[model samples]
Target chain A: MIVWTLLEWLAWGASGLILAWMVADALRVSHDYDEDVLLSSREGEMIMDEPHDAA
Target chain B: MAQAQAVTETKAQPIGLLRVLGPGHVWALGVGIVLVGEYMGWNFSVGKGGALGSLIACWVIGLLYTCVAMIDSEVTSTVAAAGGQYAQAKHIIGPLMAFNVGLYLVMAYTMLEAADALIVGDLVVALAAGTGVEGVDPKPFVILAISLLALLNYRGVLMTLSVNFVITAIAFLAIVVFFLSVEPWNPGAVLHHADLLAGLPYGWLGVVAAFQFGIWYYLGIEGTCQAAEEVRSPARSLPYGTMSGIITLLIAASLTWYVAAGLLPWEYLGQAITPLYDAAQASGSTGLQVFLFIGTLFAASASANGCINDAARAWFSMGRDRYMPIWFGAVHPRYRTPFRSILFLIPIAVSFAFTGLLDQVVTFSILSGLLGYTFMPINMHLFRKRWPLGSIERGYVHPFHPLPAIVLLVLCTATFFATYLGYGVQLLAMMSFYIVASLWFAFHRYKYVRRGDQFTMPWPRPRGY
Candidate 1:
């Protein structure tokens, strides 16, 4: 069995951190984009409602 | 579709990037741009450092790429322009630096595209030879490849990414297959090769030399940011795509090295153009060999197509900014794509492809890449000073502030010098580009700096956009 050196371990750890960040960010953005779509639709509806209310 | 058509016919809004891409699409582009390396070319590192040294170099390069990606994500999200690093450098640093970055980016992407076109030809010829197919010159196929990629790019961004996603997916799966096909670990084999001294054949110097090929593992990750304008939400998706893409590349690169080297001797693998296929063939799997041959073709296609998209976008941005002729800024009246710029690159790339100067082109690509990378640290620092936290809404603020960028700058600088020492004459082609750009800028200062054109900005969307 090949024993990993301290530097190798550190490299793995760093890569681990990046991978974790990637996953977390992907999930976060997926959720955020959903909310963004919902909010944008609501905003559009509000713009439509303004004309109706004025009428 | 009717509304889009009507909009197109009435006024045909000026050349602008379509916002049809999402994080996933950006991820595909990022992955596709570098997929060529995982399947081939990177094995050369083993010749320099053996297995262990090359692995170490890859780790360091991967870290540098991670840091560079993070910094780019932060800057890209905040700026959100098609110009990408060039725009950021312009806003934060100065025009001179921006021009340099823009030219460097163009050079990197063009050289990469040209190199990939040649590799596609080379791969097809090699495959034909192995399969007992008859004689054929690869030059026509090379031209056909470049023209085909240009046509896809000119069609639309959506088509480009869709094709990129499919091919990149295959390339990654091939890597996974390669990993799976490797023989089960033998403690005795590793013990017998103890003379490898933990895989470092020539020691630390070898590791330094290995940096050249090690960078291939993540050379084009930063290009993802160039698609910022087309992304649905740049602030969020840029980081997501770029960071995830970096992780995917790291995994693919490591597996590629381990499985290929483990199955075959590092020395033999070092000289292989189709290392992954060679490794799979070593496993006695005709099925795997054929699969890899097909995968190599698609991988080259994906890299070339994605790179042309990036190069055209950068040139279009430069044209819009008056850094180059406005003819490059022309968008197709009906297609709403940068058709002129895309077509313009075909001849230049085909010329380079026919020259058969893959080594010089790769050297030039790396030299320009390092130049652009060295500017990122400076851009980040200046950016933070110009727009501190909470002043502007941005995504993925890199922790520890300047450290990541600083480390990236150091790595890029060291690699630049190393590359120069190793391939100084070849890199003169890249230096010559800078001299030419300088001369052009000196003569055409007014056009290059006159600033009425509005580029996409994150906050307070630029007027006329």
Candidate 2:
């Protein structure tokens, strides 16, 4: 019984750590520079003097 | 000159299966093979407890999978595509969510291919142990098997389905025979008494623990939707196949559990790595073991081959949409199949097998799948409002108005959390891997579009009824 409890806890603990990492990664991406800004910067450099349609 | 050139380019031959399966049969075969193998393995794990608690855990998880299946059916029917969950989520949510789901699915399927390869290897080693073939390494065998399956898929979907049909029939029969042959019909054992509950080592947590095992049985239910394009009369076939697959799995699982429990004391179940094999031995029916071995081999082969066929098509679709490289979308000149993608999967699957990471692969696959499943109910809710069901509909409506979808959402969220908690660092590492890969690909695609890079291929439009 003790062994079983230990194994279960170990499994849970390992999973928790992974979950935390995933959440942290998601947060980092969300906090980074706005996607639109990044997109416009790249677009401006490439399509200078040319009419760009949004649609 | 221009007119002649255009005519020649437009006359490309169709690659892969034209229309061998009605949606219903494809659904049945897809759901049936995976569920049988999954339940057999899971029951072996749960049946060891011989306690009432484990039995209830098993049944509850089974019920959860049924609910998930119904939700998947609704979503798939509304947004039928080769991309399966990715397409459904994209339609209901947005492109970003769809990209994430697709990314996760590709990772999951790749891992699944590896895990199936490992199972094939393990089964072969076990079978060869008694034979004179001594000291056989299963790695080479696994690699060989996956390679062969990839080649079969590269040939076309019709050939793949034909093989799947034969294997699925044998596997289904084996399950029926195993259930019937077990002594003393005792469905009461599943619900009766308290001492049985105490046998599960996880105590209160056993419920969730058993859920992982139970849900595994219903893992491939969504495969039917992935093959919707190749299926004839998909509208009628898809729904019928989805429902039939779920019902068949439910019946098979219940009967297998009941008979296995009645035949042996529950305590011994866990100790026997292969419960059915042990059961066959005890019954003095040695032939049954051979039957099961062959059945499992076929089941594993069919699943791996079917998955390769389905996954390659999805990659092709993604490529056609300009979401992936044109090379992935390219068809074989003679075969008309997505030969490039099929060839690519072989190495990835083989690499996974060589790494000896079957458990990790399976866990990650399940976790990703559950995440995909969370979006299913949401899609169904949106779809129901947009396109209400007709009076002729025969399926049971989810009770409590919007509550069913809401409940599934909560349940799936909880399961995801539980999975992360259960897998710990491994799950974290995998998620990070997926996020990085998805972002990179998304950026790459954006760059390609911004450059006015002509795809040269025809854009895929949604097929109308």
Candidate 3:
């Protein structure tokens, strides 16, 4: 019984941590960058080696 | 616009979806999503059509997906967008078609992700039960699985798919290893083929019915195209990577059928939860059983992982075009991933998982995917009509254009009827859901779609226009 309780709480703790991290990161990125630059990437527009697509 | 332009000119950094992926990741994303079907769900075809009937369904529907791969490879080669078929629809058909198609992609994959997480949770319960720890709830595990995968996808595309590649390969190799262990060359030894082999219990209609489940062998391979925007070279990588995925599925399907059918009686094989694992157990080898168990778990995880990636991309694309809230379209500055879209879909997938209606959700997902395939032909015709061969650059051009379209249509229709035969209520439910969704879209968010700025293809002005 004790083991099962621990397992459930562990699962919950891990999931909550991950979700909170993602939310915090999303908030940070939103504040730091301009929206237009964030959305600038287009479909198959940029090649990896040469980054002229955004320009 | 000026700040954007100034920043772009200075750094020229790629904005949306990091473009570090290659064919290997594309193959991983595509196969990883579909491989779970081979691990489970597919055996249900045997339930419907019998073993021989199931094989016929596999071959016939194999041809159906072949056409799907070809169509997707060709169109995706040119369009090279994140939404896969939805992107193609937007480019060629019109806005409404694109909107519905994108919705289909999001809903199908999101539901599938839910289903896979459910499977993982169940498997975890089973694992615990094996250790005499019974009565474990699968819900928390399911939530844990979804949240962790959402984190992986939220961080970056390359790492998400890279992890998928390793696990998917292990899951696939498990099938190979099991096939060899059975010593299929000497079927008389362990297989008992003579006693196990049974003729089709039903008849031709059973074969037709089996076609409904037949898609399991190769479903979701066309998802390769969803990686187009992220691939280093969409033209070269998209076509070949997708093609490689289909060929690999074909081989895997044949081996899976040959081995499982030989080991388990069709009656048991059809209804078994883990057919391959059950087959391994039947082999009476502890090593093989462990291998297959690991394979099943990894296949489910890999599938959930890929589904998150694809669903988020489709939702992100739709959001990018303002068909839904524009906020979902935002990409993470550091990760270059569709962070918001990924976060948004996690709850939706968890909701579906909690529903615990596994068969219903999977059926709905498969039916949605079938509807998406039916649109491929229409998208193809318009694509070719506007820009005939040689009119513009294409990464890869599929040969014998209209025939594959016609083949895909016929097979899809047969499968739809097959689905109707069993899941009649579910079929209607899916259509009604779509109709209601279409009505909701028309009345509500359709206004958000910018009519003028669409048709952003970089090729020559379409010939007729």
> What TM-score, computed on C-alpha atoms, does each candidate reach?
0.84, 0.76, 0.95
Residue A16 deviation, candidate 1, in Å? Answer: 48
Error of 1 at B328 (Å): 1.3
Candidate 2, TM-score of its B chain: 0.84
Worst 10 residues of 3 chain B by lDDT: B6-15
Candidate 2: which stretches are off by over 4 Å?
A1-55, B1-17, B43-54, B186-201, B263-268, B385-401, B449-465
Best DockQ goes to which candidate? 3
- Candidate 1 has which clashing residue pairs, if any? B52-B199
Q: For each model in turn, which proportion of the native inter-chain contacts is also found?
A: 0.00, 0.00, 0.51
Higher-lDDT candidate of 1 and 2 = 1
Please write out the lDDT profile of model 2 over residues B1-465, one tens digit for every residue: 765454344333222324456654575446544654442456633642333444664666566666766676655654545566666665555556666776666666677777777878777677666765545567756766776676666556666667777777777677788766653355443323233333556555655555555556667766677765566555566777777877777776666565555555666754455665565665567787778777677767766776677667666655544566654655443234566667666678778778887667778777777767776777767656644565224233444546667766776765565565467687688778768877886666645532233221122332231
* Superposition error at B100 for model 2 (Å): 1.7
Model 3, B341-427: lDDT tens digits are 999999999999999999988998998899999999888888899999999888888889899999999999999999999899999
Off by over 4 Å in 3: A47-55, B1-14
The complex in candidate 3 yields a DockQ of: 0.42
The whole-model lDDT of each prediction reads 0.74, 0.59, 0.88
